[model samples]
Target: MVIDDSSAMRLILGRIMRSLGFDVVEAPNGAEAIARLQSGAMPEIALVDWNMPVMDGLAFVNAVRREEKWRQITLMMVTTESEQSQIVRALAAGAHEYVIKPFTPDAIADKLALLGVLAY
Candidate 1:
């Protein structure tokens, strides 16, 4: 799943996910993403954006980590928040990986591979 406020970003990430042999689902914000999850959309991995309205990525990670059913979903933050402290906070909140914005598709794939969500 790709959770981002920008439709363009969603499109870009969705295309990348599809290219990597995965089905893609997208939500414009964390709240809508949660709704999709509650409605039985069980994505193996969720690429989330940090600055979205109606529930930021950190809050989404916290919410997902609190639920046993959502434990298997790998959360990756794809955002412009590049501070070392921000990355640490996201990881501490159960995000499996973090990718800053302006990243290449290869960078994303490599991170997914490192997280074991994608095969090299």
Candidate 2:
């Protein structure tokens, strides 16, 4: 799933995931993502955005990490939060990878590959 407050961001990410042969799902915020999970949507990976309304990415990461059922979902932060401390915090909060905004599709693909969510 691509979880971002901006529909445009979700669209762009979804397109990239689709091109990589993924079936994409979208949520506008962390809360909605959780709701979808509760409704039984088990996405293999989630490309989450920080600095969202309702609930942010860190909180979502923590929430997902706390749940055993969600343990298999890879969490990747695809956001503009590029500070080293922020990256550390997101990783500590259970994000498997991080990608700053203004990134090329190749950058995203590279990270997803590193995370083992994509082949090649």
Candidate 3:
């Protein structure tokens, strides 16, 4: 799953995910992503963005972490917000990995590999 308010970002990330053998699903905001989850879209990993309308990434992470059924989903934050404190907060909120904006596809792949989100 790729959750970002920017359609271009979503397209880029979705393409990368598909190239890496994932069936990508996208939502423009955290609320819609959560709604997708509630509707039985059990993605193994979710690439989320920080700044968005209708609910941000941190809140999404919190909401997912609160639910027992969603615990298996790996949450990765992909956003422009690059602060040490922000990273710490996302991790504390149950995000498994963090990637800043303007990243390469390789950077995303590397992080996914590091997190074991990519299946061999």
Candidate 4:
């Protein structure tokens, strides 16, 4: 699932996921993503933006971690926040991986590979 306030961002991420053989879902914010999940829509990997309206990515990560059933869902931070401390905070808060903005397809592929979500 791609959670971001920007429609262009969602489309970009969705296209990338599709190229990687993933079926993409979208939410404009953490609230919508949570609502979708509660409604029985589960995506294996969620690409979350750190800053957004109606709830941010950190809140979403915390919320997802609060539920036992959502433990298998890997949360990846994909945003423009390049602060080391910010990255550490997200990593500390149950984020499986982090990818900064302006990232290339290969960058995402490498991280996914490390996460065991991508083979080769």
Error of 1 at 112 (Å): 0.9
The sequence of per-residue lDDT tens digits that candidate 4 reaches over residues 28-108 is 999999999999998889999999998999999999999999999999999999999999999899999999998988888
Q: Write the per-residue lDDT of candidate 1 for residues 1-120, one digit (tens) a residue.
A: 999999999999999999999999999999999999999999999999999999999999999999999999999999999999999999999999999999999999999999998887
RMSD of 1: 0.5
| TM agreement with the true structure for every prediction | 0.98, 0.98, 0.97, 0.98
- Compared with the true structure, all predictions reach lDDT values of 0.97, 0.95, 0.96, 0.94
Against the true structure, candidate 3 has what lDDT?
A: 0.96
Ten consecutive residues with minimal summed lDDT in candidate 4?
A: 104-113
Decoy 2 TM-score against native: 0.98
- Taking the candidates one at a time, how many backbone clashes does each contain? 0, 0, 0, 0
Expressed as tens digits, the lDDT of each residue in 1-120 for candidate 3 is: 999999999999999999999999999999999999999999999999999999999999999999999999999999999999999999999999999999999999999999998744
Q: For residue 69, what is the lDDT in candidate 1?
A: 98
- Estimate the overall C-alpha local distance difference test score of candidate 1: 0.97
Ranked by lDDT, top first = 1, 3, 2, 4
Error of 1 at 18 (Å): 0.2
Q: Is candidate 2 or candidate 4 better by lDDT?
A: 2
TM-score of 4: 0.98
* Candidate 4 residue spans exceeding 4 A from truth: none
